[model samples]
Target: MITNFLHDNYKNITRVSILDAKKVFYPMKYVLEKRDILIDDDSALIILPFPEDIKYPSNTKMTDAGMLWDYKVEISINNQSALTENQLMRFLNKKVIVVFHHNDGKIIFGCNEMPLQYGYSEDNSVNPAAHCGYSVECRGNSYYSKVST
Candidate 1:
């Protein structure tokens, strides 16, 4: 179903590893540009789900590269109380599905599982919501080998 959604909506999606932080922003940037979503607010981060199958580069020292991990996601709007931790966690815990709807009533779903790793305030301060960023780490097994039809 997710695969169908992505195939019907988005043009294409590039899979990037979480360890590859340098390229991680590319998909985010692409989604923002295509959706015309403004990154000025924390809501932008909420629109997209965290990616899965994050592995370190071959040269990295970490041996357990294929293990699956969880992530914490936070979406800060103008008001910090707009969304509570429980609510945020629930949203992030939802199935990793992204459906891109076009004006023509056609939909394309991203054929990828976007799992959240973790979340918290960037400044380490608890206050009104300022920015929404995720603290994601790998979890479980890698799904990179799973093929799609």
Candidate 2:
């Protein structure tokens, strides 16, 4: 049995409300879909799964206000399609909010107040046959919390 549920649909995240970051404002309340992580149950929010390489040894610095953190995530989207490429372009030089849903019902949120800045990097190929698409890197602050769902 094929496990790629989005192989046929091939959708991408074009909106922030896909995961509803508002509901997860606090640590206790949250949401997730681990069993069907890539399943776009809502027609309003068609999302695809991309592997994220979160830079380790996360650095936390002390600031005048309080503590501050810096994070970097490398997302590899493989080859979704040309249409997907167009949609992904909109993220460049933009503030992107990401809700990383874990298998054990936990979510790593790209800070709601200070969303991450996104841009493209290390594009594998331009040749249509071998084109893998952009390797997006999002850098900013983040917080972790348990998923309420």
Candidate 3:
């Protein structure tokens, strides 16, 4: 079975919408980072049935009995000359529903339920024109499905 769903479709995402507003379209050169964690699984081990006549080693089975569907996502921003540090501070701290849209599907996730915070880029000294650069982390249910384009 092919379980690597996110790997096969990450690039299809074309936009990200925060609630009903704040849409960030794709192909933006300023996207510093993007990632998704899918299929976080935990399984139980079961002893396998063995033949009496054959002297075979004991075998075990892996069961997807307690699989966890908790998904996580991270998005980083960079080089936003139009946004100021103060503005970014306000935006990053709010709780909002984030919608990721792809050519073949979409996923909506929650952020800031525990409060979202933004961090400065590692190399912050080079750009001094209030070039907006920050990172956001989000977590949500892992259940997602593709839709017709």
Candidate 4:
């Protein structure tokens, strides 16, 4: 249900843009991957591989109060894009606002806590159409609702 909730909520996001310290625009592509969802009872909990021995307590009450769900979004840079990998890293590593836009609405995912870092991909020197990618972890307390156009 969590994965479906994320996909249904964000699947419409068609664009990702960042505003740097100098207010420069750097648009990037988001390479789709099966989104990783981790449910935690605490807001400060870091997600880890689910433990096999862990069992859900039957008497547990459901509340969104301190619940936190982390979604790992993988963004990419297309070779044909106007921006380069170097250019992206320069501003992305610093404080910035990452905006996700869809046809109906948008979400301003605050990057103040989630700092983007460089990641590796297979060499595409031989291939003419390969994309470079980076990982970004976005945290949210409540599920997003789809807005009406």
lDDT per residue as tens, model 3, 105-138: 5444432222112223322546667434444444
Candidate 4 lDDT: 0.33
How far out, in Å, is residue 5 in model 4? 8.9
- Sort the candidates on TM-score, descending order: 2, 3, 4, 1
lDDT score at residue 48, model 3, on the 0-100 scale: 18
Candidate 4 error regions (>4 Å): 1-9, 20-65, 80-83, 111-149
lDDT of 4 at 44: 19
- The runs of at least 3 residues in candidate 2 whose Cα sits more than 4 Å from the true structure, single-residue gaps closed, are 1-57, 64-66, 125-131, 142-149
Angstrom error of the Cα, residue 134, model 3: value is 1.9
TM-score pick, better of 3 and 4:
3
Instruction: RMSD for all candidates, in order, please.
Output: 13.1, 9.5, 18.8, 14.2
Q: Per-prediction TM-score, please?
A: 0.25, 0.52, 0.40, 0.39
Clashes of 4: 0
Instruction: Give the lDDT ranking, best first.
Output: 2, 3, 4, 1
lDDT of each: 0.28, 0.44, 0.34, 0.33
Q: Please give, for residues 42-89, the per-residue lDDT of candidate 4 as tens digits.
A: 221111211221111112223443223233334533343334444444
